[model samples]
Target: MSKKQHRGWGVGEQAEQHYLVEPRHLAGGGDVRHVSEFLRAAGWTDQSRTGGPLVFDSPARTVHVAYNPFVRPGGWTITGKANDHEPEWNVTFNPQTPVEIVAGFTDALTKSRSAHAPNPWAPLRQHGWETERAQHFTAVSPDRNAWLQFHQTGEGQAHWWAGARTEHGRTWDAVLTPSTPMHLIEAFSAALADPQPVMRPRGNIPPSRWIRTTSVSVRPSELGAWQQARISAARAATWARNSWASSSPRTHTPTPRPYAAAAGAVRTGR
Candidate 1:
């Protein structure tokens, strides 16, 4: 059966798949600037789509690019659709990293250790959170070396999604919309065989105002970091050239809302 093109979102000519990555899992410890540069170098053009194939046009070649970030408090979230319709998920350093990060961030945000214990769902659910019902939960577990997995392998509204420790100890998380940390215990428990992973309702999820942190530019000694970024980007370009021999059928269109917040607005999960 052919998957229908989503209302406003575009779809590619070929079948769809999923991909995942974590900036932290890379050689650099999740340096946002470096990651962005690497992806751009990897044949990922900033071009948007209207209603057809999802092809990433870059200097080297055109390919599909789907990426997710794991800077959230709970387990990571995958929230992107690529040209070939592949969902982007990411790898992690360990199996238990999701569970551990989610638990720690949740506690810090809700309990309020200090100003640094910023609320994850602040701007979205400013008033507060309402527990829908009592649910079973597992203990927090965070192993640095793990492969965070994600797939639409579910029936009806339920889906099959999971992340486990990889042999090389690489953990990847998907950065979905309204990016925030998740409670891995809750996420894993939410994934059961029967009904499928309960699909999160579509809505406006905003980030907390307090979560915005700071960053310092690389000093003269930090030039090494830039050098590595260039290398990674070059490698990415090479990967893109080999991945897509032919471009998919695509349509050009504009996206209504660029992201949760505007240019000057505070960006979540930075």
Candidate 2:
């Protein structure tokens, strides 16, 4: 058999010439406040100090989520700090990333997980992304438009990155620092792997000559149903069942927050 050649670049990868009507997770991540709202729903209190990064605290005030929108690059820096037992970590999302994509990270924040070191790439594989070792455990999205990677130094913490590209070149991306908790990254990976075509405005996306945008004309349409083949598949936490009664999902459901209660404000000595 003759080796397949891609129109643009990479191993067996053809240039993404199809215009994505509703693209992947690059739709300027939704309302910034929605994250705080989700934290509240997951039982974390919003304790942001005036003129400071937005703050969210666990009921006992042991864990804090700090979000600053004014960093040098002009995006959101959401950091999870553990004054108790939760690991201290940081996550960043460029303004162009979709909120749903970011939620893939935040949604994972609620799950109960074990202590064994996590394999963030597993979720990518489960999402049908192909993987290989090339300086890192790299996984390419099924469409070849997006990529996620993970690697660790000798006995050191792991680092992570997720990004999507257009024929024009790289657009939006995220960085998860070593201090970040792994399962959180896992959840994020799952979210990125989801195949659902999110609704996006035509002009909001990059100048792409390769993609075409199509709108949903009906429910249960073949395109809609086919797009959700992997989306409806479940990716709950590793060792525990969902922690609470959540609303029905149009698609992916966040794992349960078994560790905390409603985000009602609680004052405690740190």
TM-score of each: 0.25, 0.61
Model 2: how far residue 90 lies from native, Å: 2.1
Which residue ranges in model 2 land beyond 4 Å of their true spot? 1-21, 48-54, 82-87, 114-118, 152-158, 201-203, 210-212, 216-270
What's the C-alpha lDDT at position 136 in model 2? 79
Query: Over the stretch 1-270, how does candidate 1's per-residue lDDT look in tens digits?
Result: 111221222233232221111211221122223223444554447453554222233343322332223333432222222334343322222222332233222112211122243333232122222212223111212222222222222342222223333444423343222222243223322221111111111121112221122121122222443346454535544555465554532222211211111122222242
For 1-270, candidate 2 gives per-residue lDDT tens digits of: 111122223344322211223345444454555456566656667777788777777555544565666675656566776646566777787866766677677655644454567877887788789997877778998778888887666667677878888766777788888777777787788778876544433245445654434422222232333333322222333112344444423333443321121112222111
> Largest TM-score belongs to which candidate?
2
> RMSD in angstroms, all models?
21.3, 14.9
Candidate 1 has an lDDT of: 0.28
